[model samples]
Target: MRIAAATAIAIAIGLAVSLSSVVHANEEKLDYDHQEKWQSALDRAQSPIDIVTAQTVRAEDNEPLGLQLWHTQAPIEKAEDNGHAVQVNTHATEAMIRGRHFTLAQFHFHAESEHTLDAKHYPLEGHFVFKAQDGRLAVIGVMYQVGDGNPAAQAVIDDLEAKDGKLPQPSIDIASLLPNQRDYYHYLGSLTTPPLTENVEWYVLPTPVTMSEKQMTTFLSHYPHNNRKIQPLNGRAVVHHQG
Candidate 1:
């Protein structure tokens, strides 16, 4: 009996040590330098979007934006990341503005956060990509900060339970998670991903929603360093509303 108990203890200790090592190794692999990589990647992507004055944007004609609908199982053609941990590229659906009969082609998440205004880091950031019939692209960026509880964000995290690296069915209704105000910061930028394509119309919400510290930590656990540093303004204009 004594010998059996000693053997069990030894095995348990060995298992713990092995598991610890594995966790450390994974963390190391996730340590990516955001600035260097993003700069190089952005340089490669220089496609510019047709400039349209913000004043010319027709609010009445724009389609009423809806919650993002996602499906992780629907064949992810691409999957990669920057300073962030995981970005499972998968098919998704999103409603375009009224005049724009468009839909979201893909969606992904960023850790720690990205798309900073001036100089601020949000807890997390989710990017939904919409492609127009004419090949124009508009990216809706939802900014998240640590706060109370965010049901919308929780929905996404819950669905991620069984999926870490692999894409899983996404719990959506993301529109509700967004700020009530449609006001945003519009700019011309490149996709913040690999082989960065410059053909991107960035629609960044000026207002941000809240998430719990626990929730933020949950994402950080999977991706400790998610931001891709910051990109230069490059003589670009960042337009925001005065309201």
Candidate 2:
């Protein structure tokens, strides 16, 4: 009996050591320097800019404001906690710009928004990532403030709690999550996350949608700060468009 107990203790210690090593390896893989890669070389068009609203250029009157999102038709499939953020996936979400078709592939949120409005940060920001058939990318950014709690948003948090994911990316309707006033600020930028891919189109809404304190708390609990720091505008133009 004594010999058996000693063997059991040794096996348990070995298992714990193996698990600790695996966790450490994963942490090393995730810990990366954005500055060492594409960010340093292609620094001109980085995203998460502080939009000085006063300085934004007005779109020409003759220009066509071609951005359109058919969010009502979008049906979410599943949600996953992708370490960095909770990413909600959908097979299809449609959009159109200047006669070009795009699909909203997935969306995720960042706490304490990536972009700032006249140097002010919001509680949360959601990025709806869209992709054109030819591989071009456009992202629609919506800011969330503390106000009347959004039911659809709340439903997402509830679903995440039920599932117990490492992160909570809500599988809610994109339309239900957006602000009624879609007036937006548009520009050319890069992906906030790495590879830091450039030449992406960005449309950030001026009017913010509301989520309650509880919703904010739950999201922050998952990721206290996932947002990238603000990059320089670098002669880029941000246009104000009427929704």
Candidate 2 residue 32 Cα shift, in angstroms, is 9.4
Candidate 1: stretches off by over 4 Å: 1-31, 34-92, 163-171, 241-243
**CA RMSD for every model?**
18.1, 16.3
Model 2 stretches with alpha carbons more than 4 Å out: 1-41, 71-73, 164-171
lDDT of 2 at 166: 41
Q: Model 1, range 1-243, lDDT digits (tens) per residue? A: 122232223222122222112112233333356345433223622322222344323322323443223332244433343233544333455454423544655555676567765556677777766665655566777777888787755655665565455445343454655677767655656655443455455677658878888877877777766556565555455554322
Q: Mind giving the per-residue lDDT tens digits that candidate 2 earns over 15-93? A: 2222122111122223333533423336777888999998887665655555676754455645546677766666466
Clash count, candidate 2: 0
Clash-forming residue pairs, model 1: 61-98, 61-99, 62-97, 62-98, 63-97, 63-98, 147-211
Sliding window of 10 residues with minimal summed lDDT for model 2: 19-28
Predicted structure 2: lDDT: 0.68
Candidate 1 has its poorest 10 consecutive residues by lDDT at 16-25
